[model samples]
Target: MIGVIKALYRTQLLSIKGIWYLFCSIRLVGMNLMALLYVRQKLCPRQIAISENGISINYCTLYTQSEHLAAQLAIHCDIKPQQKIAIMAGNHNILVHALFALARLGADIYLLNTELSATQLRDINNNVHFDWIIHDPEITWLPPINNLPTYHENQISVYALLTALPLTHQMKIEITHFAKITVLTSGTTGRFKLARRSGQAQNFVSPFFQLLVKLNLSHYRKIYIATPIYHGFGMATLCMSVLLGATMFLTRRFEAPKACQLIAHNKIEVVTLVPLMLDRMLTYSETRLQSLRCIISGGAPITATLVKQVLDRLGRVLFNLYGTSEAGICMIASPDDLAVYPTTIGKPLKGLCTKLVAKESAANMRNELYIKCAWSTGGHYWVATGDLADKDADGYYYLNGRVDDMIVSGGENVYPFELQQCLSMHPKVKDTAVIGVDDEEFGQRLVAFIVLASDAEQTEAIIFSWLKTMVARYQMPKKVIFVDELPMTEIGKVDRKKLRQLLS
Candidate 1:
């Protein structure tokens, strides 16, 4: 098996020649580390940047890069020491360098998501000027960007950092008045949570990519980030990659077949994926995914079947981590955990705390999972989360569902999330969600709403068999209703309440 794996890997590597021409444009990016790298080591403020070639970030290099960025600011945007700017692009190496330069120059940074519609952008722009809007040139439909003043950067958002870079010691500003950063929460729950960190706030937690590089997990020179950078998961991956000194391979658009080629050719490591994306990759390839050291899974829950399929088909490098924008990484399921309990989301990360709170009441032990951490962000721009959960005697927290989606069925509790996760595993079920319907016999009945793959109808018997084996009798959906798509919020989380209302 090992020999076969090696032979197959060789075949995949050779196929990269077909795609090498695509990465030729990477030369357009230049490094300009001047004086910005210098910082108090006690603060540990200097975040590291790594490349597939090797990490070239040193004190002198970082310093030079900072100085060069400061020079760019004077040459480009006339920035005042006290002024703040917002960066509206996904993760780019230039963006990270820009953040470092911004900190050195005392300019505020606001991280904005690219998915916001024009009306939504208008509301956000009202809060602040986003003085500079640097984005993947591919995001062409930005009506909000057209509303902002012109910036000097091209394609990448590096210019945002350059505009804020020039004010080193030239213009003095108070420490309290340095750049502030806002990370919009990935609304896993019903509502959005906005987290605001002060210009000098140390609340931002560094991601784990640096630790992975220091440990030499793999020889991946390029970090493949196909997800949206504005999301917390994508931002964390990008931040960690730059700090680890990896060249970020970004896709203006994500396509599964093309993503496969990048992974094999660039020696990409640490590819962050959402469950749906993973499903696409599994559908695209039948053989082992080549050259990937750690395919980190997060963003949403993956069913046990999907987990098993990825592990068996791809190599043993699947690292599953429990996530929330609010609490950081709560738990990590390593390769060993996948071998034992393929479905488990793993144990909590060092600083986070995990608990499962009952959905109905305190005595109701069978509830979804809830977690608390010192790092648990208080609120997203002061918006709180309404996720329901439960905790066990051993501290293993299992998710019940969203508190808002709770269905009281014949005095029994129903969590739409758990049912949805289970139903999504069916081969015929491209996507599935459970919603409560007003029933006369059982206060509420579980109803499954599905959008099948290829529009090919699947057998209810097979789905019933799978559900009977995976869930309890009462936990199962009473009726399976096929749909074109499940209701979703602006941030991409399933809207159970909306689905329930639709069914009603």
Candidate 2:
């Protein structure tokens, strides 16, 4: 008994020492290394920065490869500082390297959505007038333009370029301003606009520090980013992983089963994704998802039903982040908040303020949410979100769909989200979207596009009957359209405008 006690004591002492050593290392070396990457453009020569598909690349090699490519761009491409360059590619090692290399060269970079068609791409370029286009070889749909150079991903392969470059430490370039990263809006409603980021340290520091404190982010060392890196949510997660000295696991595409497998295989502790990804992932057995401790869902409004399902299946790990391209992450619903108010977007983050401007009626108290944060556009104190929301007595905010999405049927206001929540409760419904469409009688009528569960046969009459029990008569969808799948934006929100276009 005495021997066992002594052994246990020794083991405890060793564990404590190990923790102290790790804490010291992270504070002393890890933080300095990250700062060096941002300020001095110096990469950690020996520390692993990124890992994908069981392959890893240290910061030194990543920097060297980026330097080689930057040199080539400077010589062959004649790309200069502050010139607008558009990059259209899927998430990969090449994309990561290109982002850093262009930043070092001080170019204004636009990360175009990979899902854009040739016509859309052309339209965007015609409006923005990019100086150069760097795209993946798979993007053959891009139209040719006179005197404008297009660099293919295969041409600037980091791995291939690294093999040819001489093994030597290259001097770091001093960029006065980090490359301004421009992300295009989802364009689900109408024309897409550029949302530019200055890439300043001060802009990210406050929110990042708050996130670290509130989300307990240090606990998550291995992260899997399931969203497209071109989007703000995905990009933010990537930057946070680098800042925290965490290992990241990424794939070019997101498949539910594959995502689950990757999470389990890689022991991914944190997963940042949209609600659609979570819904799809939950279709599989929960036993496959043992390693995930936190799931960050954002980029769209998640239904309460879906939130409950996630908590039940995946434990209380769902955290909903609410924000837009114009306004960065303003509100974040922690697991505790979700437990209390399932659909609440939670309170404003530190250094952020929110107010509701009543547009319709003061009695109703539902208003458009206006926010002011460090990341707001044009340094405005109050940036209009164009999204309608309701705040409870407890200060939790509930999104009531977009302001434009509200439909008035027979002189009664009907929010599509109310109908959507009602429809989502139906066990037969796999996915659902509600939109307002023009009507000859009513100013606008509600239309519901629903994807039913596999092997579940339910007629429109039955669904309408079920919905009648939940929502008001005026809120009933005038038309119920059955679809194999609803149109989704790149970030996984239902594309209401696209659905209306299809109906038209």
Candidate 3:
């Protein structure tokens, strides 16, 4: 707790001037009754809030535009409180402004992924029953729906609409409650499920403070968010940027060279990305990332090889975050923790209760990880993570695999993640994914899909010879297939379903 206070002080949020601006920013969102009593002041009028595509937007302009957009939405689009609205777009200034405007209207906002297919979108819309859709010009291929109002970047310019509206001292509007936002799951396995975060500020106190102290985010003045804003990891970064008044860097689409250029030119201090994005950036020169103080990797399973590689190339700046969409962020592995055990996911965050539940009454068996935290979806009750894990003597936790992903081969239990981790340690293997396939003698056999290093040449026999010493006989893969690259999900997880399709 003392460390949290120190971090906040370092960010200047504890000072008198900072307090005033913080209060004003909250008031601008219309989240409190005290806002009505306090004197009106612009929220960080001169401070730059967001930078995207070589353009910068200050706080005053952001807030004012949000106000104007809110009024226009209410009058022209018939947007009202409790109305369900969907925003399907990438990270941009308009996206930020639209979020603020919708919050001011006290609407229920659903964040849709840009990678979602049209059929998936239709399925989601049927369940959510959205009142309106605000999307970018790139997403112009929306399915036709009767009587549905949609706003597109190419069809309607938000700034132009706001400018066309009449200017008044104040709009006749009062926000009685804060907006409710629904974030979708990664949908890696199947259909996406809706996950709602607690809107109360008190609910965020535990994890929020823990991140500030552990990541030292308060000390960073510039941050580059390389993940999608619709995801929990990226959304948290967006909110933190506002709270600390740090300059945020965003891009509609992620490109390795472009991202490297931006980070190098801007001298970005903090970077939030997935492991795949980090790997792609590493393909460029390491000097481009020398300006970074902290690099946060989440939204996917990070291998031990990647951890060691990051430490060797980037010093002690890498942090691995292990979490789920429903559970939110629960564990953080710092550089020191990774140095000790590259495979460990470190310890649980403060105010979280974590336990392992076994599938059977057998001893020395890996168990499913369950967590109970204030910020998670369920209240007070333990949320099943569906991940099989075990803890070391020193209390560091390591994931074995998913409970459903465990395969029974020759009446023996085998976890694919274990084999995949071992394969990833090989010098010739760049990346790999292991899956269970049907077998005649054994109930199921493991098949390894590997992507070799660009400069290395290896055969299945050589890989098998190397793996003989590393893994047990039952754990060995029955077949090894080399590929140029493995299919990946939007959030950077290996697409096992697609890998299984290749077997067919």
TM-score of each: 0.67, 0.84, 0.89
lDDT of 2 by residue, 1-504 (tens): 344334323323224543454345334323222233432223224566677777887766666666676665655567778878888776777777777667667788888887787778888888888888777666777756412223334454433443455536643444435558888885433467778877665677677666775677766668888888888888888787765556768788887888888887877889998888888788764677777888999988887778887888778888999987865688999988998899899988878888888887765455899988777665657887878888899989988778767778889877887788778878898889888887889888889999998899988899888887788788888889999877666566666667888786
Model 3, span 1-504: residue lDDT tens = 799889878766676766785567465555621221111224345677789988998766776777788888787778888888888777788778777777777788888887777788888888878888777766765656422223334445554555565656667766535566788885444468888765666777688788899988988879998887878787778887777668889997777789999999999999999887887788666779899889998776787778888899889999988877666789999999988888778899988899999875485377999999877888698988888889989999988888888888998888888899899989888888899898999999999999998889999999999999999899999999998888765555577878988888
Global CA lDDT computed for model 3? 0.78
Descending-lDDT candidate ranking: 3, 2, 1
lDDT of 1: 0.56
List per-prediction Cα lDDT, in the order shown. 0.56, 0.73, 0.78
Predicted structure with the largest TM-score when compared to the true one = 3
Which scores higher on TM-score, 2 or 3? 3
Q: What would the TM-score be for candidate 3 when compared with the true structure?
A: 0.89
Model 2: CA > 4 A from native:
1-47, 141-174, 362-365, 408-413, 427-430, 452-457, 483-487, 495-504
lDDT score of residue 34 within candidate 3? 21
**Model 1 CA lDDT for position 15:** 35
Ranking by TM-score: 3, 2, 1
Output the better candidate (1/2) by lDDT: 2
**Alpha-carbon deviation at 245 in model 2, angstroms:** 1.2
